[model samples]
Every structure is written in structure tokens, then in C-alpha cells.
Target: MASRRAAGRIVRGLGYTSAAAAVGGGVLYLSYRPRDIPGSEAAAVPPPTYGEGGIFRPPSFPNVKTRAEQIADLKRSSGTVSGAVEKAQSGITSLLKGDANDVQESNQGGKDEPYDLLVIGGGATGTGIALDAATRGLRVAMVDRDDFASGTSSKSTKLVHGGVRYLEKAVFELDYNQYKLVKEALRERRYFLDTAPHLSSWLPIMIPVDKWWKAPYFWAGTKAYDFLAGSENIESSYFLTKSKALDAFPMLKKSGLVGALVYYDGAHNDSRMNVSLAMTAALYGATIVNHVEITGLEKDADGRLI
Candidate 1:
């Protein structure tokens, strides 16, 4: 797999958002026709919140700021970020233990130490968090109730594809935020194949086009999907003849098959990847522990998590 250059491109600036989904089979990357919504047709809605429901919330201090706002704030506070990792390292220390509640208070680096990050759950999301923080030189610790990737992470279909359905919805609803999400996912899909080649492989998926006319239609969609991926794309998509499609998969019924759209995605061992992330984090000085269920949380006087 070729490494994609980090040629900075400005995708649609939305609110700060992170999405996770169970890896699945090839998405139906059908081309979507963007619909233009008139200015009068837009709905009048309040800003969204980051936390659960809260009534009588103030407009100035919004519970959740959009991605645009978050980026803007980062730019404004750019000077304050120097030595951030060092500070986090000083604040947090060895926080991992077999028992979730077992905090070695007498130890030099114990529960009393100020942690930079406390990642709950040991699935892909949690381990990814721990790895990212540890790599940044932050004091990070992760705890999972059970074994890592024992949940949906291990149960994934294991194909890493851009969410074509989300793209379809974005185009239909004229939601630029959704468009940004699709672009992000596509980029990450490429990253997985590029970084962890040992654990991941390219999977050629065939979209059987039952009707002759539909071949061009589906092919166009996949082309757009490939284009969105840009340098991250694994390989260019191409059409296969009916006989060629049947040859690729002998189980297909030959009667109505007109052609197929063949595209490249990624397949991997989801559980192993999750474990690898945790191990990598541990190697980077993060404390990773499992079978530690967090029954409750502790907070300080300021209502901040301890």
C-alpha cells in the first residue's frame, strides 16, 4: 500500500466531531446528486449540546461548541499549548491496576497524582485514546471492564470503507458536516491499510450490477468515492464484464447479472488491532489495565473529574 501524503486540504469546517462505527463490508458507494435547498427552506434550530439534556442553558457558554468554534479557539490559544505534553506527564503517573478501585495511595505515582487523561473502556476507541495521549507524552491510563475488543470491536465485519450511506444523506440533505465526516473516514481507512499492513489487507469487493444501465450509475458513485479519498485511495475503481464478474465469484446467479463494480477496501483483525493499540500505548508509558470495571467516578469541588 502506498503512503498518502499529508497534503493539507481544507475540508468543510464543521463542529468538533468524532465518529466511530463497527467495521463492515463494502459500502454502496452510489453517486449522490446534491439538492439545493432554498434559504427559506432551512429550519430554525438551537445549537447542539455536548452533554445530556440541560434546560435553561446560557447561549454564551454553550454546552457544546461547533468544530469551527473549537478550531477558532485553538488558534486563539495557540501560545498556551507549548510543553502541554510535559505538563500532562507531570500531572499523571502510573494509574493502571488489575482492580479498578485498587489505587495504591502510598506509591510515588498513585491515584493522588493528577492524570492528564483517564480513558474508560478498552475497545478500539479507548485504546486509540490511550495510544494518542501517550504518544503525545501525556500521562494516560486506560481501564476496561472486560478484555480489550471483547465487545463490538471484535464483532466488526472488519472492512474499512468510507460510509457511502452517510455521503448519500449529506448530499440529499445538503449537510456539509456529514460530507466532512465521510472525507475523514475515507482518510482513516487509508491510514489503517498504510500503517498496519501486517494486520490489514486490501479486499476487492464486487458490486454485481443486475441491470446494464445501472452499471454506469453505480460506477459513477464509486468514482466519486475514490475521488474523495484522493491520495488515500487504495486503488482506482473499474468495471468488470458479466462473465468476468461470474469468474471472480462462481456462486453468483448468471441470469440477470449485467456487470459489476469492483473497488478496493480494507480488511483486518479487529480484535488484534485493538490489542495492538493498547500494547503500543503501554510501550509509550501509558498504564493499561483490564478487568477493571469503573462502578462510579470521583470529582473535585469544582465538579471536575479527579
Candidate 2:
């Protein structure tokens, strides 16, 4: 009888647990289920509408060109390009044919107009000479074995410096020639930078001072350099502190680093500068040609070049 009573109690406990679980689940479902607020239906975005063509188009779709329009544009571009190419070819052909005709006439002993000066090369020096002669009202013609500035003129260090090293030698050895060369170079450097402002620029160069004593020495030397440049100086020389030096040149050795002296010099694109010189000479009425090799020179009985 006691066992039967215990079994009845267990069955009643299970029935109560099941009823609690059902109530909890119903409350959870009601609390967490999605609900629509009062004005949310009106606030919702509507589906995009397709126009009469039954196709959806983006905002930019109307700006897009049709196939025929694109084709016409391409055709116009190609025609412009072809016309420019043809014009360039005609100019080059005319120049080459004219040069060839001049040579042929000279070889055939025909009396052709003679040039006042005939430059044998198209390097910087030769082109400069041609330009000078042409500007002075002399007929000038220039030819090169290769393209202009193809040799050492193009392979330079590209620095239009005033020979700071030469100044050092001039001071130490008291060499008048070196001093004069430095002065001339400084004047030429100024002229070069001024002439081709587009191709050249002032560059700041730094000299590291490893020793404390060397700081004042380099500073004085650079100051002297600026003095020599005088009114033509691009910028004045300045001394930098040790920390500032490191900031400017991060790769410098920190130990025994006293300071640095910064000075200004001119730098340029050498090859392009040389080519521009040649073109300028041409514009000054000098006939400039390239890729014409001179195997030999002919001289008259009076030892004059013919």
C-alpha cells in the first residue's frame, strides 16, 4: 500500500512539471514572435517599377552610348591619329629627301648654295656652335654619326655643379688656373640653369661632418663657396645640428657624427637637355641631322675644308 501511494505522488509530480513546461513555452512564443508596429506598413519600401519596355535601368544607363555612337567615335579618333601620323611622315620624308638632294648636287659639282658653317657632330658642343652661328646670321648645317646626345653628353653625372672640389684644390695649392676654372664653371652653371628652367633645378647637397673640428672647416668652405658664387648663388650654405643631420640623412653613422653642411647646386636631365639644345638650334635656322657618318674630309689645295 505504501509503494502504491509513492507511485501516485510521482505521477502527480510529472503531470505538474508538464503543465509548467507548456505554460513557459506559450509565454516565450508570445513574447519573442515578430510583431508589426502601427505605421510600419506605410514606412516599408515598395518594389521597383519596370517601365513600358519591361526592363530595369540604372540611373547611369541613359548616359551610356549606343553601339553605333561608339563606333562613330572610334572612327573619328582613328582618323585624327592617322592624319597626324601622315603629316609627321611627310615632314620627315621631305627633310631626308632634301638632305639627299643636297649631297647629290654637291657630288655632281652642281652650284648649290653653300652653308657658312657645317658642324660635324650633333653633341652639345657642336649643337651649341651651330646655334650660335645661326643666330649670328650664318648659314649652318649639323650632322651626327648617331642620334644627338647618344655619347658622353647623355652619360654625364647630370650635375651642373660649380666645381666645389676644384675650389678645394685652388685653396690648398693656391692654383690660379683651378680658381679661374671654378669661377667660369659657376658662371656657366648659372647661365645653364637660367636658360633651361624647365630642365634644371637647384639641388641641396650635404657633406657629413664626422669630426667635431671638421664641422667649422666644412661650414667655412661652403660659406666661401657661396661667396664665390656671389649674386649667382641659388641658395646660401647652412649648417645642420647633429640631430637634424640624422633626420636629413638617416643612413649616416650615428657614432662620431658631429653635424653636416648643406650647399646648393644645379642638376638637370643631361640627354634631354642636349636634345633640347639641338632642337633650339634647329629653330634658329640651323639644319640639324642625325645618323650621318663622316668617313673622310675633303680639303682644297689651299688646305681649306671643302
Candidate 3:
């Protein structure tokens, strides 16, 4: 009888608790419930409507300026600050139009003045030189047999690596020069990614370790690569388990597979990068033209080619 009384008390306690909780919840709901203000009925906003393409189109306001008009007003207010914008727009227009005659006329010097430098080719090397010269305030003229980057520059593998093979040779042959070259290449790789972030990005490459013993070798090599890259390293090298490797690359040979080592490098759109360099050079006061060839050279009495 005493145990039954204890159980009855427990059931009563639970019932009281449940009643309290339900009452609290109902009170909260009523307190936070949305309600119309006394005078806001007339000022109620209409529901948002979807326009074509399923986009939410807000209601238009009166006297809203279009984008072009807004820009014009801004230019008027900013005064001379808009000159830079106009110049950049003109440069873009010139680049798009590819007016060789305009470029030639703009770059022509007086009878006594001569071009500081004349680049014979508009390939990667020549365009890079032109850009450097132009940025340094030199009068530069660049001519190409064909369009910029239309030759070997466009036929690249699109990889910007630090020469892992060179690193390996450096290790095996104890060649300090090869190691230095790798270090410099790695730094250049970082520069390429940083300078043109839109055109270049980090690429993850997997080196399969077919032998169990080769895992340590490849891992050490990749770590060394990262170390050589130093602060310029994009990401650290890592190892992947056999199962993960096979999952990532299904075409791998399963026999004697011992996982893989992955390392980071860089890749870029080579042709686009070259063209951008050329255009940037042109913008920096370098005269660049295409579809011209140099057949022969004549030397003056001073041993200078004319």
C-alpha cells in the first residue's frame, strides 16, 4: 500500500509539470504573436512579386536615376578624378579595336629622337621585355610576325611547376645549381599565381607510389619541394591511403599499389596570360603591332643596325 501511494505521488507530480509547461508555452506564443498596429493598415506594404526569370522585382520609386545617369552625376561631382577612368576606358577601347596605325602614330618619335627599344617578336619573352621597358619609362616598340601568343606561347602544357624532376636530379647528383634553379622557379611560380590570380591557380598533382618502399621516398621528395618553396608554398604535401587514391583515380593500376603522394603546383591559361601581358605592355606606353616581319638588317657606319 505504501509503494502504491508513492507511485501515485509520482504520477501526480508529472501531471502538474506537464500542465505548467503547456501553460508557459501558450503564454509565450501569445506574447510574441504578430499583430497589426492601430493605424498601419492603410500603409501596409504589398507582397513582393516575382518578375520574369523568377527574380524578385521590388517596386520602383519615382525619379530613380539610371546607371549611366548616376555615373555622369558622379563624374560631374568628382571633377578631375574621372580623368583616370576615362583614360582606362580609352585604353580598353584601343586594346579591343587593335588599331595598329594609331599605335604606330602615337609611338613615332621626332627626327632626332629614336625608340629606346624595338622588340622583334611579340612572343612571351619579347612581350615581357616590352612591358618591363615600358614600365621603366622607356620608349618601346614591339612587332610580331603573327598575333601575340599565337606561336609557341599558346602550345604550353599550362603547368607552372617548380621542376620536381630538377629537384630529384639535384638530390641524386648533389648539384647546387639545380637546387637553386628549383628554388627560383618555385618563387616565380608563386609570383605567377599572385600577379594574375584570375588566370592562374594552385593545382594538386598525384604521384602514385607503386612500391611500398617508394612511399617514403616520394613523401620526402614532396616535403622537400614544400621546404624549397618556403614561404611561397601554396599548400603542403600530403599522402593518401590506397583506398582513397583508388577512389580519386579509378583508372590507376591496382596491382602493387601503395597509395600516393600529392603536391601543389600552379596552372594558368598560357595564351590568355601572354595576351594580357602584351595588352598591359601596350597600355604602359609600349607600341605593339602584329603581322609584320623583318626580312633583313642594314648596319650604319657606326655598326648600328638601321
Model 1 Cα lDDT, one tens digit per residue, 142-221: 77889999999999999777876677778789999999999998888878876887787767777999998898787877
Write out the backbone clash pairs for model 3: none
Off by over 4 Å in 2: 1-111
After superposing candidate 1 on the true structure, give the runs of residues whose Cα lies further than 4 Å from its correct spot. Answer: 1-112
Clash pairs for candidate 2: none
Model 1: number of clashes?
5
lDDT digits (tens) for residues 1-306 of candidate 3: 999999999999999999999987865554335544222344233467799999997754223233353233322321111133343344445545865334333333232344556678888899998876655445566778889898999998899889989999999999999999999989999889778877887788999989989987988899999999999985677777788799989999999998988888999999899888887776665567777676665556666544
Candidate 1: give the clashing pairs.
Answer: 15-66, 15-67, 16-67, 31-221, 91-114
> Candidates 2 and 3: which is better by lDDT?
3
lDDT per residue for candidate 2 within 42-109, as digits (tens), equals 42335677877899864331122333542333223211111323433443454456443332222112
Instruction: State which candidate has the highest lDDT.
Output: 3
Which lDDT values do the candidates have, in the order given?
0.66, 0.69, 0.72
